[model samples]
Target chain A: MKKIGVLVGVCLSALLLASCGTSGSTSSSGSKAKGSYQTTGTANSGEYKGIITNGRYRTSKSRGVGVSQNTENMLNLKSFESGLTTISKDHFSPKSYVFQEGQILSKGTVENWLGRKSKDNPEGLNPKDNGKKDANKRNPIYVQQIEEQDYMKEENGKLHLAGITIGIGMNRKDYYQKEEYGATYTTDIPKEQMIAEGKKAAAKVLARLRSYNAVGSSMPIVIAMYQQAPNDSLVGGTFYATTVSNSGTQMGTWKATDLKNYVFPVTDTDTVPSKNDADSFDNFKNKIQNFFPNLAGVTAQAQYDGDSLQGLNVTITTQFYSETEITSFTQYVAKAAQTYLPSGIKVDIQIQGSDGSVQSFVARDNGDKGFYTHVFSSY
Target chain B: MKKIGVLVGVCLSALLLASCGTSGSTSSSGSKAKGSYQTTGTANSGEYKGIITNGRYRTSKSRGVGVSQNTENMLNLKSFESGLTTISKDHFSPKSYVFQEGQILSKGTVENWLGRKSKDNPEGLNPKDNGKKDANKRNPIYVQQIEEQDYMKEENGKLHLAGITIGIGMNRKDYYQKEEYGATYTTDIPKEQMIAEGKKAAAKVLARLRSYNAVGSSMPIVIAMYQQAPNDSLVGGTFYATTVSNSGTQMGTWKATDLKNYVFPVTDTDTVPSKNDADSFDNFKNKIQNFFPNLAGVTAQAQYDGDSLQGLNVTITTQFYSETEITSFTQYVAKAAQTYLPSGIKVDIQIQGSDGSVQSFVARDNGDKGFYTHVFSSY
Candidate 1:
């Protein structure tokens, strides 16, 4: 009986050790089980599971870690190559979330892969967590930001190729038309559908634009703009990229130099979001992340590297408003050109007031870096 | 003696008949043993021999004699598939043309295509010469009438997939400063070379544009513009096209209501034997034929057809002024457009004065019941 008891104890200890080894390394093949999303609305709902390899980092919170994680944990950063973990369109473009994985990831055993880590150990594993609570677990804060600048140098900067657009609006048209005092005609699709189409269109346009290299310094690209109304009458809005030029043949401003430059209230009116309504910054970031995760890095603390260019101009526009009631609006559209924006370039921003007055802001200093100069009075 | 004389006469008659038969049917091959071209600026050159599976036509005096030709003459009408003959640049895109042996070209040959006539005969070899003659052995006026129409359609209407920009300029430093001093910089390349490049760029751009379908009735297109000198410089022009739009919250000119109300130029430009440079036009046309010989018709009445289109807008700009002097200048840019433009479409010509004032003329009707409107002088 004594001998039997000793054998049983030894077997239990060995099993425990094996289980612990499985959850320690992220780069191990099948090391992290795939993750799934259970979503509502336009989002997809299902459980996902996958393994990470080649320098992938993972967090138990970002994806459901398998019950098999050991004392140390690994994270999945495999999205850099094989693409990213995408959620169906439950959220609109420009969305954000504090991602969490419900459990430890399960990576299948690869003795050879794990054997290359440390002096005392052969298995390559992520360093152990500094004895902190596992709530934040392996999840790292991913900062994402986006900006609009010039057209030519934007592609090389971020090294990212964007081919997706996500947005949300009223999926219903009756309510939207009613709220807007009966506006009609535009897209052939219904309001909600149109909004969805618009969102998809934007994504498609960007994807295609990224495929080619066009740098016409002659004209500032002009386009049409749209906005969504809240509720069943709408889903999202749609717009087009178009242009009209002056006789002199140079684009003086984004609004166009051939014509007097000014920002005016949107000719058409639509519903205003209630402040009580959920603030949607998180949702926006979430959707955008689906297509362009790196955009969150737009928040850069840039310093002026003193320089002069033989022939160069830097132009960017940003709009920030935190207002509850949007009685009126006007949209200024330009292609996102930050991907290749030169590092040391002068920037000019035109900030407009509700009354159509304009203020030109030139920022060669770090202090002036931020979103567009135009903001609503209430915001 | 009488018997001998009779026998001799009989033999002579027999010999004479035999000689006549030999002269009539010559079943053997002629001296067109091979084909060769002087190596020069013709980017592409070749030799091919095709049969008239159907009745075809030839306009070039050098082509379309009998079926046994083995030289350059036998290669006309593009009867054969691959031996020789320069194909258009369009054949190099994602999609290309596939021709079988014995197929006839509509304009370059005697008949439409082998067997494509009212009668169905794939091997029909009957042809026409029209017997019309000019100093160049082909009617220049007739060719102008036909090719100009085709040039407008394929060159301007098709949707563009993608393209590259040939030239880029951030600012007008050289020409602008010099225009102030009334100095016009002549191009090192002769007028013939400039015209040739312009034509080449046009064909290439057109070929690339044909691969895509219109986007939401907004066909993606590239513009191959001849950026004319501001009466101050002679520089080769550039071409640019777009398959993608800049990522902005706007739509481009497709949204402009002006499309519905817009009218075409009213009159056509005049074309006379240009005084400033008499040989320039013939040389220009010859340069084009060398590259695309099929563009010339068998009757020498060459006409061009837009590859495929419902309606397209074309604006042509040409000058009849010498590089050194501006006298005897007649605007022939939009001349053919007025007489040949189809219905429901607009094509035009614009003339610029020494001081930069402009006048416009509309395309003429194709003589069909359908007529295009000319809104000349409206601008």
Candidate 2:
């Protein structure tokens, strides 16, 4: 009995040592297991168990020892409001916040008790909550400071922004500090949800601008939502959605007036349509090839409004076997272009000789059921 | 004595097993030990212990069982000549080789026995050796073949080759084939040595091209040598040397006539001078700043011919504190530009108001000296 007891004790000691080794390995590896967000109700409820503090929401679980406390212990609504006030004092002008479409909030309105401190009182105690209040008498609009950046694409000396990205948090370093937030990080939100939120925010901003009558009505705007992550940088971010809106005109600043023009250079290789409109232009060129068997090669330049075809300029080089056939070839191409091309597109055709001389013709849509008519042609 | 003998036998068996295991490990690991090149004489002699065959030299030592045999066994001069002939037949036109200054070689010079089979007779068996030579009687110029490709740099819609690249040997796949020559890859050649060889080759080619009177005298040509590597591709290569040569006109075609033009748009940010001639333009801008204390910002568009400054267009935006100060400021800037700028460089200055109206002035070189004379002033 004594020997058996001694063996059992030795086995138990070894098991304890193994358990301790496993726990030590976990901490030394620095691999923090990611925590999953749990929905309180429906899967797509968009609400999680967290409290919004310091411009971001924090969950209730403790990340690890010496890292972070539970959310309930650290969160303070009054302190958060005070921090916001301090930030606003440093970065924004007094009365900068717009309320009720076009009215600027008076100084000290945000500091007063009227601004809701928690979700319990979404709207502060105001007589105007009855929905009959005048636009001038509403509470100040409160937001967690908006950050905007232009996303530009430049080609051939033309610079334009496709959209504007708006971030909803402070700079990356401040948001990513492990001492403050522990292992907490932002994740990607659904695009449609972000778009809906961006639209709501943009509507308020536009209404305020309209009340002040500051900007032109025809100006275009793009509101994109960026969920701030720990790794966000100045030039890039995790974007959720981009929504384009116009103030008054349907064709706003983003709409380019005409397609960009290009000129194809002469080369020894067989010429083809530019890659920008290869499908439609190649089909047209092939049809013309069926008409003129003496054609050696074809080169084309085109203009487009976005991706839609606007106009085409084509040059055809021939073997120059027969001078008499040149007139018939030009006529045939002009007719073929008129027959094949879509309505409202302008076509310019040029037949190039072996010696580099070019004969030019222009084909235009007649607006008579997609039939094309030729303008003056020079041979 | 019997026990001792048995012990010795057991130890020998263990030793044999260990040796076999080591050999198995070497083969299984696929570890190839690199071998050093054997020099024939002094390090700089450019000769190695190898045999020249198939247009490439090969070493004597075997690379490994599955790798390749040494260079001596794989190299064959006749096979190399045949390969060249085959490549020429497929890719080159008849009479493509240039023999004498401007003379194209007739069809079968490469295959004829009179042509030198080795480097000992570089020009082959000439009639001069027999003392019956005539300049007119010599066969038309012949070369194995000459190939040319453009090395292009594309920017801002303009595509140009600063130099022309000439490659020796067949394409990459043919050169790198393991079946033809085991372990005979191009990586063994050092980059600097290849560059030196390419420079020498380019100089010879340029001299030969200059001897030919067929091309325009003023044409500028860049001859860059490319040592064909086993991994040669369209987008990238291991370049050796690039040398520029001018034809009869010393000025050469490479000298661009006009400064590349640029346009700068007004923006809220402070504008700097364009990258072309930034130093001189910035100096002139600083001097103008000394004259105008209320200047808000300055944006400049300038033109340059290579590194030389040609013309400058500057737009200055300033606070409209006083109308009288504006005229004096314009005069000061115009005078400063004339004094600071180099002769023959045109300077156009424009002062813009907050509302976008501009006052213009033109500063021209007087030509008598460095003095700049203002042609016109508009407010």
Candidate 3:
């Protein structure tokens, strides 16, 4: 847990002052006060059925948005930064998380599930405590939205349904492989207890939504977010079976589920391709994996919402690959997506650049997600 | 499309008779008619979950005579001897699918969604068809069981439902790196014709399960598989949904929903261990990528399922350095797994030997469903 050389913050004099003191252990002041703050998300479009988008259970030639089943109906993110100074008693935010860059974060999830409370009294002058209703439990559902540079409780809102909301930060770890000395979130909470907390989060989000009268009388929804699994087994990412809030907030980010792989809709092309070339597939997988250094491979899982009679806003986002060799590969996979995917499935692939710039393409019979810049390396 | 070599079938005298006094092109029908096969697997005693005893999904913590996820699931296979044939179909009854080697498969899933024909040619099969009930369209989920040197059908059986069921599989293809050949799957059934066929299939599986409804009510199951996607957006994996079956038999198998990633359960313990006194998570990811001759790193964007639960079931599967590594990293990965993963989650690590043999470890909490043996690579 000892971070080595993080000088991103600290002025020269501050650094010297700290080192000059006896014992040399710096106190947690001077640096920007950081705190874990969460925000919710809502989709700008309609919902579809879950299995329908899966490649195997197609009833129509619909386009698929790459949303995992485990993700709840809405998208939720909570910042894991450590320094926090309240804008007011009811408001607080962080400059950044306390962990190191590229340091696989496991505790963020445990923290997300278990929302923070002031540890002192329930609810008094510290609006952060929210009247001490449930101080000890974590929902594991973190929804982050960093839209406004300044967030005021009355005007600068915290949740947005659509319209590219920003400010949220997320980190993904690996799935198939584990890192030595890597940290992961582990909880002693029992399964039944976790389930109970999941249910409560769902209810809390629902209540928050209803209070805003944002309930559009639509079918229930689910919220989902994908982060790297520190390892495999317990689960990665967070899934909440939920509905959207009219206030543009993710209503309920719940507990994890065990539905990573399910038999549902599969693509028509599952039949070994004309070439049936394993070499090709490996090449493609590697190509994409290169960009998303933490990712293992690109798997086309399906998403479906039970809202009937409407067009869906489907989005398929990809992770960053490691090298240029894979950059082309990942882009190729994203581009080839236009061919193998169903017609109705409006496909778009995006890669978060090293500097966090997003490169994307939306594939269709007409519009392209901009997958090809024409660079091939298949030797 | 040119095949490397053909397996001749006719006797030299017969071949001469057929060729008469012609040139050099010769053809044989024997080799193709009955290629060879092999036999190898593990089994446990008693019943565990919906799986058979000591079935594939079993770990030392519990003996999971669980349903067999696949007659074959350990990946990285590479042996092509002869004489391999199905000894029996549904060897343990319940209609079909019961087998000694397959333990991860869910019995309830098999009973309810596999290998059954509809009693009433149920009219109005939903989305009308091109209207012909082609037996080829009868793609029922089928399982070929191995019996005493013969293949037989296990009719009239049952299913179990203890809690939840999970199915796992591994895939390798160079598609992600290959852009021109990328593909995907879709769930849109635009014609409305396949819907009727799908309904028919569903009805048969439903009926069969009703017949064996005494069990399987309490179980929630998930079947999982991995597919390598092209690095490009427009290509690789399937874009359309598909159901697997050939006429009449009605084997209830269906494909998986396509998503950007297929999140598998795993743990932080899945990290690649440091050897020779070295340690760090980033280093671990690098090592994993190096292990796979074609894999890059781990998968990203996973969604967890359990909210209030204590320990989640995460089984980190593979580790490699990159997509183009030799086997050294894989061996090191396997060794690291033994040291890192606990007795529970069950580690099934594979290492390819110089002599065309595969060394593997099916480490469970305690049970033989876990194995330490050698086999040929098939994946």
User: For model 3, how does the per-residue alpha-carbon lDDT over A35-143 read when each residue is reduced to its tens digit?
Assistant: 2212111011110111101111111111111122112221221111100011111122221111111111123322332333355422111114233223233223222
- Model-by-model DockQ, in order: 0.00, 0.01, 0.01
Question: How does each model score on TM-score?
Answer: 0.14, 0.21, 0.21
Local distance difference test, candidate 1: 0.22
Question: lDDT order of candidates, best first?
Answer: 2, 3, 1
TM-score of chain B of 2: 0.27
Query: Candidate 1: misplaced stretches above 4 Å?
Result: A1-379, B1-368, B372-379
Candidates' chain B TM-scores in the order shown: 0.19, 0.27, 0.28
Model 2, A231-262: lDDT tens per residue? 32111122333344555423222211222333
Chain A vs native chain A, TM-score per candidate: 0.19, 0.27, 0.29
Model 2 agreement with the true structure over B13-61: per-residue lDDT tens digits: 7785566445533332111223221111111111111111221112111
True-vs-predicted CA distance for residue B145, candidate 1, Å: 29
For residues B230-281, what per-residue lDDT tens digits would candidate 3 score against the true structure? 2332212211122322223243365534322122222455322211112222
